[model samples]
Structures are given as C-alpha cells and as structure tokens.
Target: MSRFTSICLGFILMMVSCDERDSNPTFSHDIAKIIYHNCSPCHRPNQIGHFNLLTYTDVKTNANKILYTVKNRLMPPWPADPHYTSFVGEKVLTEKEVGLIETWVKQSCPVGDSSQIPALPTFPIGSMLGTPDLHIPVKPIRLQGNYTDRFLVIKVPFEVPRDSFVSMVEFVPGNTKVVHHVNGDLVRFEFDKKKDVYDGSLVDNLVWDSTIRLVYKKIGLLHDDGSYPTLARSVVNYLPGVIAQKYPEGIGGWKVNRKSAFVLADIHYGPTVDDVWDSSYINIFYAKSIPKRPLQEFQLGTLGVSSIVPPLIIAPDKISTYHSSCTITNDISILTINPHMHLLGKSFWAYALTPEHDTIRLIKIPHWDFNWQNFYTFKKMLKIPAGSTIYIEGVFDNTRDNPYNPNNPPKEVHDNNGSMRTTDEMFQFIITYLPYEEGDENISLE
Candidate 1:
C-alpha cells in the first residue's frame, strides 16, 4: 500500500471510533434521553416539580441536584416495593439509568452533537386522554397572595343530557404552584340550593398555635353528610405527581346515571403558594361504547375500614401508627391503589392475604410525602380471590421534628371533634378495581 493511502485509512478508523464515543455517554445522546423520559414529566414547567429539566442548559445547571436525588433514590418519586408487582408508568430509574446520570454529572455535563438530540414527546394539552366531552367546574378561586393554604368547596351543577359512559377523568390545575392537590367526586345530586362559602363555617371551628394545625374538615365534601344516593365516589383526583385516571383497555368505564346532577370535589391549596388565580376543572372523557366490565372504586380505610379500626387522633409531639383493611367478598381484579394521609403521614404499606394464608404484595411506600403522592397501577391486573383481605397500615408523626407538621408547636390532632382535616390525619387506601371474570386477570390496566 502507498504511504499516503495507509495514512488516510488509519485516520478514517480513528474518526469512526471517536464518533462512537460521542454517542456513547455524551449529554445530548445519553443523559438527555434519560432525563426526558424519566424526569421531564414532573420536572418541566407548569408541572409539580420545582425546577425544569427540559433543555441541556436547564439540566446542566441542575445536574448536581439531579445526581443527588437519583443516587439517593428520591427523584421520579415512586415508592411501591418493586418485589411485589411491576407497575405501569413507574419513573423509578433502573440501576443502569441511575448510573448513567451519575456518570454524566461526574464527568461534567457535556453537550455532544445536538443533532442527535431527540424531539420532546408531545404531551396532550387539555386532557391526557383527549379533549374532554364535558367540562364541569366552579368559578375560579382567587388567592389574596397571603401564601397560606386554602381549601374551597363548591358544588357546581351539570346537566347530563343522557346517560354517559366515562372512559377517563382528569383534574387539570390552572396554577400548579398554588394548587397542591385536588380530590374530585361524582354523585347524583342537585346543588342549586346550596350557597358556596369562602373559608366556610368548617374552617371557623379550629384551635391551633400561631401555626398550629387547624381542623379543616369537608374541604370538598360540601354537605358533611354522605348525603348523595351512594358514597361519594372519586372520578377525578390529583396529587403533586399523579396523572389522569384511565381504565385498562376493554375494561369498562364507570357509568354516570342519566339526567343526574354532579358535584365538583373541593381543592387543597394553602401554604407555599402565591397570589395567582387558579381555575382547576374536571375533564371527563367518554368511551366509544360501553365496556364489557364496569370499573369500581372504593375506599378501604376510615370509611371502609373492616378488619380493625385505625387511629385518627394524633397526640402532640407523638408518633402514631395504625392499620385498616377490607375483606374481598368475591373475586376481583385490582387495577390501582392510592394511599392517602395528610401532612403528618410518615410511611405507608398495603397487601393482601388470601384464604389459604398466602400473601399477595400489592404496593408499599417506605417513605410517604404528601406533596408527591400518586396512584400506583400494576403493569398487569392482579386478581385476588373471593376469600382474601386487603390491608393497609401507616405511621404518623406530629412531633416538631417532623418537617411537614404544618404547625409551629405540634398541637393535639383529633377528628375536628368528629370530622377530619388536612391538618388532622386519617389512614386509608383508595382501591380501583373491577369484578373478576373468568379471564379478567389477563387484561392490562395500563
């Protein structure tokens, strides 16, 4: 071979190898992909996360924070015990994914060839499912810029022209920073006679220190009485990092009675906010046709506690723990479970015990955060037999050491004389399931 040709070939090989390295672990190719997929959903603006991780600049600026959260198993907060059942939409990074971020940060975030950067995934604007068929909302709530947590309960009337099959429901917040969480319920009732009150009579009856806990009951349950035809079932609910509620494919949507009046569940937005106005609303999606199996949702704690009564009262400067359960009368396919506690929650666990004494691990959150709670859905439906019992237990801390106590000097927390509040505490599991059929277990709830 001629000397010139040999030199050219050698140069070409080195360039090819270097190109491979560029795509190997560079920020544009590797770290960006991981962040966009796992962290971007919550980390982006207009979402719950504090900072944005959309672009290389945003990510590089916050690379150290990201590295710490991922290494400590904090960001992309999913608390379910993976050993039990693999879940859908779980953003928890795998060991490899976590290490990739750590390496990118340790090496100083390098922006490789920007051309290889992938396009951002387009998330739906109005509704995650699609444009909602009906929008039922109360007047937008305005904040006075006090930076105090506020709860508003209003019953807005909606006329359903005919029977509707709801495929999905979503709570889209107007201002996420001011709107911490929202609980939406659907019931067959008329609200024309009810008058909407600001800081209603319920909030008036509470004793607390300068920042002591207030017993704010019925934050959304307008009539304290479970007055609707049936228990107020939640069709739309929101936590900091949770998304829309859509049932599994082929599994039917919950049916709303024909010509019925609906109530909008109240919202929780108090401390850690601005004067921004929030007009959160509920978006209901319709199914193309009725589903084969209808979805059913029920609470398994406080209201539905069957096995043993859990504690609702929290003493001053004390840590409390309790357990609650519900017996499965018939075979059922479990789709999703939501563990709910107010600011004082410490940890949570949920599992099932079959009649044969076999245990089916459902979901467990070792550390509970009121700001980051979400619905945990199984990758595939889990079927529990007719003779099984689902149980949930949670630990509560009202001591001053607990950072989220919400009060300066932790006061005695009780059921507002009889009701519950965000400042007060309660233990329960919200289970979304459908009656099990012969082959229901094979269906996916994703």
Candidate 2:
C-alpha cells in the first residue's frame, strides 16, 4: 500500500479500538470479575477492607470510590514496583483493567445480566490454608474507648497429646478493625521442667519503663529454675493484608514439646473510639514428617546485624534518605523477605551486589503504605552466593505534606533506640533464607 493509504488505515484502526474499549461497560459483564479478583480478598467481611464489595449492589454503591482509588493507583495496595521485580500473589491491576473500571463508572454502572454474574469466591473461614490441627485461644483483652494506640505482650500456652512437629502457625485477629500487627515467637518448655504452662498472666501492656526481661518475668516465660526456655523467633506474624507464610513440605517446620506457649512479643492495635475486647487465637498445623531444611533469618538496620547510616534521625519539615548494608558470609537460598518501617516511611528499595559487581534486585517500593506491609514471597527460590553484600535504602518524609505524619508540626524524629511504638520510628529488613543446596534456584516456592 502507498504511504498515505497506510497512515489513513492505521488511524482508522486506532479509532476503532478506542470506540470498542469505551463502549457501554457493565458491572455484571465487565467489572465484577476484576473486583472479585483484586478487591474482594480484603474488602469482604472480617477482612481489613473498611467496606464490602461482594455483590453487585455492594459494588454499585461504591462504584465511584472504587474508580477513584484504581485511577490513582491506591487501592489494591501492592507497594512493590512490578517493573523492578515480580513476586507471587501480587494484587496489582493492569492498565487496561483500571481503564475498564473508570469507563464502567462513567457509564453509570449498569448491570448487564443478573444471571451472568460470576459467583463470589469461597474464602476459607478462620484459616486461609485449611483446618488446623489445634487452636490455641489467646486470653481476651479489653481496650478503653480512648483514641490512642496500644502495644501489648501476651502468652498463649497449650499442651498437645505428645511431642509433635508443627508445620505452620496462623494468627487470626478477632477484631480486624483495630488489630494492627503481631510478631510472635514459640517458647518450648520441657515436660518435666514446668508442671503447669498456663499458670501466669496471659497478657501485659508494654510500657516504656519496662524492660524485656521484666516483661518476660511478669508473663512467666521462665522455667522452674529461672532459666529461659527454647525460643523460636518470627514463627507467627500477622499484618493487615498479609497471608501467613507457608512453604513446600519438608522445607520449614518446627519440633514442639508437649508443653509450649506462643509469645506475642509485640501485638499492635490501632486507636478505637469505643471500648472493645479482642480474643485473637493461633492455629497450629501439624506436619506429616520432620523438616529437612529449616529457615534462617537476619536483619539490617534498627536492632539488626547492620546499623543505619547517619542514624535514623529525621528533622522537621524535611525528607531524608538512609541506608543499611550487610555482607553474606555463606551461600544461601532465600524464600521470603519483609521490609519494615513506621509512619514516616516514604519509599524503600533493597538489592544485592556480588563480588563480581553484578546487581540482583530484591524489592523496591516506590510508595510505602504502613497499613499493608506484607511478607513478600518469591515465586521460586533465590540464590545469593557467598561474598555478596545486600543493601537497603529507605526514604522518610517528615513534613506536613506527608499526610501520614503523626506530628502536627513535624519535629525531629529519631528511632528512639529501636522502639516499637507507632509514634516513634524504625527501619528494618528481615530476610528468611536457608543454606544453599543443589538445584535450589529451580524449586518453586508457590
């Protein structure tokens, strides 16, 4: 074809595509599937989402709000940039999907066919994986109506039939609206060392004046002779939009004694206007066999193996950048990673540099959301050779322009010696990995 003819033909095709895309989009036919896949996971009942988006009516009422959030790239809350690296179970929506939601809302959200709408997905109740072998209930805690954040340490003790293997432990928040996050540890007590595992206080408020050793004493985490029991760190954790981490069989499991207790080192709960009671519990899944490999963890920045450069002290009305680095002494295969920060966090990025000067991207969050921090799992195992150094860079905004800043007039904010309070600041990168094995990079972690 001639040049003019080809140009005219291309213009015509482009116009046709635009018309087809902008045509009358309906909720039942065009939008329901997207909402169900991306929004329903947390927007349904008993989840972190403030409202439900299950049925057609439920979505129609919030159509404008949904359109705004998707258009702004705010709602489905995947902080990691997909352009840098990809992860499993990412909830990011495509450009075309966002456009469809916008077009549907602009067209007044018509229900194309009531009978053609797809049925809502069945979300497993209480447990996301399956039925648990045992359920250990945490003692109920009461919160006053005062609008202030509270942090507490609790112990949930249980005795099983005999010594067994635990494949996983899942935390279920009783009050999803107020519960922020939990960092739990497993305490194993010898059957003969302690006669009763459930004899002491189940919960205690965390105060600035109290030391960790004092809190442990108050909660009875010691044995009869006053020696500490075996403790496993980061065994159970929970965040607003995070699913519990699980691996393939024989990958990561723990051997539990007949008498054991789960120690929630720090359980954070957000502010509430009315008094409430929270009765969260832990679900234990028994393993069929002993684990062949156990996960190892290390951290960088606040209270980690590495310290933050220039310290994590931000001044008033300023944006600052800080970094932390750690050198790997042994070859390892990585499974999951979690980047942590408090309210002032603006963005985060982490990567590894090899001795040969090659770079491997780990994760990069262009925009950080304090509410939706997840323990990101890779699709397959990642291998980091020895002599490689991992680096992390985090940016914090402590100005009035930052809506999440806690202070009215941003003051000098410091890490406050690795405090866990929401008002204070912290920066940490926790990595879970195992010693390297042959063909580890080829194993799927999904």
Candidate 3:
C-alpha cells in the first residue's frame, strides 16, 4: 500500500469520529440550556434540592440519577395530571427532550466546545418579582428543628394611602431546607403611619391595640370562627415546588387600603435542620391603578376533613377515602387551583358541576405527592356559571406501604390535632378566581 493512501485513510477515520461528536448534543449547546433553565432553579447550592446541577461537572457527575428521575417524571416534580387540566407553572419535560437526555448520556456524556455555552440565566437572590414596589420584612422566625412540624403565624405590616392594587407577591425563605412552605393573609388596620413606623415591637409600646391586636378585617376574609371579617384577606402562598405568582396584565390583582395593611404569614416548618432560622420577606408589585377585575382567593373544604374520626380521619393501618364539596353562589372565573394533603395522601380529584349539571374537569392528580404540589394556573381562565357546585375527593393511605408516614407502627392520624405535628392529615383545595363578566371566558391568566 502507498504511504499517501495510508495517510488519507487515517484522516478519514479521525474526521468521522469528530463528526459524530459534533452532531450530537454537547454540554455547551443542548444539555446546559436544559439544566440551567429547568433544573438549576432549585438544584443550586444552598437550595432545598439535595444536589446541585448548575454546571457540566455538577450534572455529569450525577448523570444517571438525573436520567432516572427525569425519565420517571420525578425530578422536575410537577404532579398535576396534564390530561385533566394544563397549568401555568408546569415544568414537565417533553418526550423528545427526555429522549435527548437519554441519548446524550448513552454517548458517554461528551463535552463539546466550551465557547458555545451561553451565560447562565440570572435569578434574584430572593424575590422573583423584580424590584418590588414594597419590601415588608417579617420578624425572624426561629425554629428549633426538634419537632415533626412547626407553625408560625406572624404579622408583617405595610402601609397604603387610600386604596391600591398589587399584582405580584413573593415569599423568600430564610432557611430553605428547614422551611416547608409559607401561607400569608393580607390584613389591614387603621394606623396613623405619620405617627409611627409600626416597627413590630411589643415592648414598652403604648399602641398595643394598633400593633399586636387584630385590626380592620377585610369584608371577605375568613376568621378562625368561620365568619367573614371586614379587613383581613388571603394574600399569598409558597409550597415545596411552588414559588411566586404573577397575575396577568390589566385583569387580576389584590386590593390594599391605607387603614393598616399587614401580612399574616402562616409558615409551616417541615423537618428539623439543626440551627434553623426562618426570617422571610414579602415583595409586592403595585399596579399604578386598579385592575379591571380583582382576584379573590377562597379555601374550600368539608367539616369532615377536619374531624379526627369517621370520613376525615385516617384509621391506622388502613386506607381511607374522603369527599368534600362547595357550591358557587355567583358566576366566576377561576385563575388557578392547588390541592393540599399530607404525607400519607394517595390521590386527589377536583371538578365543577354547573347549575345545568354539566361537569367541567378542573384538576386530577391520580398520584398525589405532598412535596411537589403547587398552585397551577390554568392555561386560560375557566368560566363557571352561577350556582355551580365544585366537588373535591381525596384518597389517603395510612398503611405501612406509605413510607413517609412518620409512625413507626402506623398509628391513627387526625387533622391538626390542635398542633402542627406530622401525625395529622388535611384535605382542602384553594381556588383563585374573579367575578365573571361579559367576556369572562375570553380572559386568560397565562
């Protein structure tokens, strides 16, 4: 064989190898984009996620775990049944995307040209709603991390002149690991801001009634007694997989008043992390003017859900199914929906029945996961005519099959049980809606 022929043949083999690597997804162009956008949000350091997937080294080291979790629909953690209803904050990967990941991993996870990698998408240190109009900080909530669960209800006050509207509200946790989720109620009271800053201190203060005591309860806000107060209202929420909620333009917002506006955050601590401290803040995005329609939030559930026995209670070593319903008295447009359950929950279904008895499927999670649940905004606003009754049904498994049940021997569980212990269970769903108008069906909270 001629020497020239040998050199040409060797060149051809090297070119083929390079071409195969180029055609496939490289760490720079394909995989990095996917990881940065989808996985890195919670996977970064100091976040709730157990591991970081921020860089090529970080992801490549855990490539197999990533493949298994994403392929099994476990990593991104969106549990809403996509066939029943589509939502706004969905993070599920497409089949094609998942396929690409599998193929890339099978190719021994090759790294391509570094220059092709794009700049990492920036995330705010705390609030996702950029440059909040108001920054109201809550007093540092200290958690000893010794209990199964801890509940802290603190009021962080903000001021308004007359009446205003806010479009976005975000809760930033102090310790993400120790904090499970936070729910806040926006309440207002009559306070002369010109007179005092309401620094949230109770020591050596004369205005105890104006500061610590309950003030102006909003007209629709519900009290513990189940009565609608005139001044306090449900404002915002954060869950394991859920973050901040931003409303659509010119359509939905929460109204605030000058009288005395404060946020009551009902923070629930999940597991104990030694030296846990949770000092969170709420950032508000104020609209220049009132929106076309105001967003209202309602917590709907059944009395049996809170009961320690019968349908509401989970009998030890057995599976239980419970049902709850609420009828709509007025025409409304639903913006979002979120179902809440504890560790032993198995499944959940929520639907609406119109006055004519036409059934509208709202959401269905055949396999309910407590840690991954969030407020799922509808792709478009859902219109339910007046006199429609919405029903929610859930199934709970209290047996040993459920690994998350804290009970070593699987004991009977009750709701709240007058404490935040994990032994209890809860059954409820929250809906964000606005009063239906002529073009209600046309409005989209995308």
For candidate 1, write residues 163-252 as lDDT tens digits: 667778777777777787766556543334223323233223123421111222333323334342332466667776667757765575
**Over 4 Å off in model 1, which ranges?**
1-24, 190-232, 257-264, 270-273, 307-310, 415-418
The candidate with the higher TM-score, 1 or 2, is 2
Best by lDDT: 2
Compose the digit string of candidate 2's lDDT tens values, residues 147-255: 9888899999999989989999999999887888899889999888888899789888876645567777888888977888898888999986677878999999888
Candidate No. with top TM-score: 2
In TM-score terms, candidate 3 sits at: 0.80
- Clash pairs, candidate 3, are 189-259, 189-260, 216-231, 217-230, 217-231, 217-232, 218-230, 218-231, 218-232, 219-230
How well is each residue in 213-310 modelled by candidate 3, as lDDT tens digits? Answer: 33223221224344432453456777755667677677667677664434453467676746577777778888867787777778665322222224
Question: Residue 420 deviation, candidate 1, in Å?
Answer: 3.9
The residue pairs found clashing in candidate 2 are none
Evaluate all candidate structures by whole-model CA lDDT and list the values in order.
0.70, 0.88, 0.71
